[model samples]
Target: MHRVAVLLLAPVVGFDATIAPTLFGTAAGGDGEPLYEVTTCAVEPGPVASTNGFAIVPTAGPEALDTADTVVIPGTRYPPARTGRGVEDAVAAAFARIRPGARVVSICTGAFVLAAVGRLDGRTVTTHWKYADTLRELYPAVRVDENVLFVDDGDVLTSAGLAAGIDLCLHIIRCDHGVQVATAVARHCVVPPWREGGQAQFIDRQVPAGDHAATAATRAWALAHLTEELTVHTLAEHAHMSLRTFNRRFRAETGEAPGSWIRQRRIDRARELLESRDIPVDEVARLSGLGTGGNLRHHLRRGMGMSPSSYRKVYQGA
Candidate 1:
């Protein structure tokens, strides 16, 4: 089993702190064996205060970091991390115990902890959009992109506030195990199976009035018919709107233009087929609306850096 250590700093965000243990703890293999061993640790074992007006009692101390295969730092209001002054000496020592090459993750303002320790220097990362500017001001070297739900920079990962941490955890599960396992975990958690990391973080926007004016129905229809040639013009007609109006409303609601959104959906469909079905590559492409083996190979390689066969072998163990 993979070992996960969640390090709780003082005044941790309660919701963020729970995400990893909940999602990872829920993951199980075919025989119902847990896939990850999750342990919550702190600099000093005892009651760690939370921003939510409560406290968490961790069973382990900083030594937990030394044996972890992955270390997660949830959002914290620790002054040194928040103010960019530096990390506490004890916190620094705790971070030092993380094994070299072990994955490091941050949830919401936890990016501040990573950044303060210089782990995020020159790395593209994100935090809650509300604090993006503050993070940027505090650590100019860490490239902060507040638009996306999360940024997965291989060994290091960061997510936007609250629920987005769930997305990142599910993503990590998918990467470690496979899509089916991740989907199962999401189902158990009563959350969506997948939300692309690049999906927009919630931003304040004026929602179009009424179901009649929104493009949600059309988007759902498109998802159901991904094998068809979905175009901006066709979607506009289906939504009973002019092409220009459809384009505007689609981008406003989904944060992606119609063409780009359709392509991504198609690619996602292709991936699902690749993992779950024993079909020819060309057949998977046609079913996913990509049309041909060559096209599927091109898109798979470009998006995932793997051929369809390679992806199947990795995920399906075929």
Candidate 2:
């Protein structure tokens, strides 16, 4: 069984900490047995007060994280008082004990603690959009993203505010096991089994309750032909707009040019090929429609700041 330790701080946002056991508890292993063993731990040993009116009694303390297969930090209603100074020291010490290759996660403002300890240094991460700017100011080494619901930077993961915790935990299940197990877990929770895109994917479109976007038919049609040669002309044709008008509408909806959107997706696809297969660079380039490895290398570096081999090594390490 995977032992998951959720590190709860004083004045904790009770909901974010609970998201772990609530989601991880639903996972079943091969042959259908329970898969994960989860524990709630406090920064200190006794009862820790929550942002909610009530408080919780943790079974263990920071030391509990020493043996955790995965350690997660959940947001607190008050990030500073509880997670500042001494609290930060305790959290860092606990993190130091984590076994190599063990996973670490943060929910909402809890990412501040992870970043404080340098876990997210040189990494792309997200928090509640409201706090994105503060996170960047405080931790200049961390790349704060204001968009996505969550970010999976290998073993270290982070999520957006409040209910996005559910999505982050679901993603963890998917990462540890496979899509099937996570889909089952999501089914049990009665949430969407899968989300379609990253934070950028949701930016221009109006997402319904708990979803990321409401992309119109134009986008729906565009997805069917991502790998083929596509252009602004073709997209304008599909949307039935003249070039100038279509460009304006697309920008208003998605916050980027049509060509830029396509390239982002193509680069995302190219990374998948690099990480998932041993195919030659030429095939990956061809598949992503970048035409050549040199172009792929240039764009990949521009977007992620790492070469294909380096990205594969870092990501595949997990």
Candidate 3:
């Protein structure tokens, strides 16, 4: 079982702190055994106040981080209160206790702590959209993207906001275990199994008033027809709208371009096949509408940072 340490910074966002253990701890293996052991700790052993009225008393201290395989930091009210000030001295020392090569993760404004410790330097990351500009200005070396739900930088990961933390945790479980395990956890937790990290954070949407033509039917049709060639023109016809209008409406409703949405769907199909089926790469590619094994290789590596075989190996418990 993996050992996960939840490191609490004082004034931590209550929701963010709870997500790690709740999702990871609830995950189980084929034998109904817990996959992870979760421990909550602090810089110093004592009561730590949260953003809300409640306070928590941690059972462990910074030393807990040293033995953890993963360290998760939730959002805090610390950064915004002091603009340029970064991690506290005690916090820095605690962070340093994490052993080399252990995965590090942050939720919402918890990114400030990672950035302060120079862990996110020159790496792409995201925080809550409201704080994107501030993070960029304060840490010029860190590449900050405000739009995506989360940014996965291999061993280091950061999520956008409170709920996005759940998304990130599910994704990690998917990568570590497989789709079935992650899906079971999601079903137990009453959350969606997958949402692409690149999907945009909600922006003000201009929904057409009553009786306006919607793209819901077209999207459903496209999902069913993923193995077929799908283009903007073809989808526009199915929706009974001109190409331009379909493009505009699709982006408004889905927060992605029609082409990008199709690509994502194709990737999702490919991932399912890779996880559940034992077939040739070429066949998987053709079934997923990626045209050829080479194309699937390119896209999978671009989107998931791993080859089809590598993904299959990890998912199959090899």
Q: Which stretches of candidate 2 lie over 4 Å from their true place?
A: 77-88, 200-318
TM-score of each: 0.95, 0.65, 0.88
Alpha-carbon lDDT of model 3: 0.87
Residue range 49-93, candidate 2, lDDT tens digits: 988888888878877787899998888755552233324566557
**lDDT of all predictions:** 0.91, 0.76, 0.87
lDDT of 3 by residue, 1-318 (tens): 699999988898999989998999998987789999898999876888999889878778888899899999999877532275776788878888899999999999989888888898999999999998988888889999989989888899999999999999999998888877888899999998887788787767666764348888898899899999999999999999999889988887777899988988888788878988899999999999888999999998997789999988877641
Q: What's the lDDT for residue 190 in model 2?
A: 94
Cα lDDT, model 1, residue 45: 59
Top candidate, metric TM-score = 1
Each candidate: RMSD? 1.6, 6.4, 2.6
Clash pairs, candidate 3, are: none
Candidate 1 residues 54-86, lDDT tens each? 999987999999999989999989899899899
Order the numbered candidates by TM-score, best leading.
1, 3, 2
Question: Which one wins by lDDT: 1 or 2?
Answer: 1
